[model samples]
Target: MIKLKAQDAGLSIAELTRRSVLLKPLPKRLSKITLATYRELVRIGSNINQLTRATNTAIKMGLRPPADPEQLEQLRNLLQQIGRELSQIETEITDDDDIESDGDSEDWE
Candidate 1:
């Protein structure tokens, strides 16, 4: 029997156990392409965040003008690249979803 402490709240231990038993477990592995894309997304996101913070700090400290042309150009390029990559990823996901839906419909026929 499953046991829950008082802090668990709402569901009883038995109910929780029953619900868990009915749920499917997660897959253990992802395709290498998926993993690589996810990692690239993370890396780009982190770089953008760090660059934004650094730019903000520089502005606040009056260390550099808010509109330093070179810095602004670099920031704009980075942002554009991020936007392009995100759009590509979104297209890929939409294509995959369409494929899955087509397969599902076939199963019913």
Candidate 2:
């Protein structure tokens, strides 16, 4: 149908597409959850930083950390989990790019 319209209007498909783009805006390009996951990662990283600072402060001042050995082990586990999640997000983003370039790349014309 677009080809027909472009032919009838005596305009190349590329020209029609260019004019349409000038008249309207493209939608978001990130079609994935990577962005949200990144934001969550930032928040988690900040919390972990604060926890580390507090623990260090307590130790420096000759007080036991509120978080003992067991708690520290749990924190380590949480960090490992977060690392795995980050790796997964990275893989997903890479896969999304691969998918777009997987013989589907096309010129608008």
Candidate 3:
């Protein structure tokens, strides 16, 4: 199992790929999981780009960018939430072991 320290801070695509390989026991099932997650991430990235474009368009249209301080705070909170989720996912990928071990069995009385 790869020991991914918190300092690693999952961020870039290359880092994410490296982390995926670091996972312990490297199960075949994990390959599919990783691909699926990667696809979803791509979609999320696309959405973020669209959002940025829309925000810029709004600015160009002379619209104020979230005049409410609370709205700005909420946006910040949402971004932080997304960051945490991504980090957790990267950690999970790096730390996961595929092969299931035979856990200790208990004798029923």
Candidate 4:
């Protein structure tokens, strides 16, 4: 008994039901990261935390940079990796949040 404009191209009740059924398991699988990537992410995060703490303590004590230039570069690369992984995590979380919110709103409608 519901009507929609042709331009809207909205789902029919049956189509909606079908789509809802298909989407039922999406939230459960959402925001999943591969185990290897997740492990790397954790390692990078730990490195960032440790480096940040050391940097902060050094700054408080007015310490100088390391004599080894390669170590500094390695730290920079690790931090960059951490940043990239965190960005990926944020995107996945946002996408999953959108999917879950859409499902909830559809329920009300």
Most TM-score-accurate candidate: 2
Model 1 C-alpha RMSD vs. true structure (Å) is 10.7
Ranking by lDDT: 2, 1, 4, 3
Misplaced by over 4 Å in model 2 are 1-32, 89-109
Q: Candidate 1 — which residues are off by over 4 angstroms?
A: 1-29, 65-109
**Predicted candidate 1 versus true structure: per-residue lDDT over 41-62, tens digit per residue:** 6777677667667777887887
Error of 4 at 68 (Å): 11
Evaluated with lDDT, which candidate comes out highest? 2
- Per-residue alpha-carbon lDDT of candidate 2 for residues 6-109, written as tens digits (9 for 90 to 100): 65345787866776678643222332355566677778777766777788789899998856646766776886787687666565453336443445343233
* Candidate 4 structure, TM-score to reference: 0.35
Give the Cα error of residue 21 in candidate 4, in Å.
8.8
- For model 4, state the Cα shift of residue 90 in Å: 13
Tens-digit lDDT track for model 4 on 1-109? 2333111225565664555567632222223344345677678768766766676677678896333445656776876787677666665563335533333223212
- Which residue pairs does candidate 4 place in steric collision? none
- Single out the weakest 10-residue window by summed lDDT for candidate 1: 100-109
Point out the higher-scoring one by lDDT: 3 or 4. 4
Candidate 3 TM-score, C-alpha based: 0.35
lDDT on C-alpha atoms for all candidate structures: 0.52, 0.61, 0.49, 0.52
Pairs of colliding residues, candidate 3? none
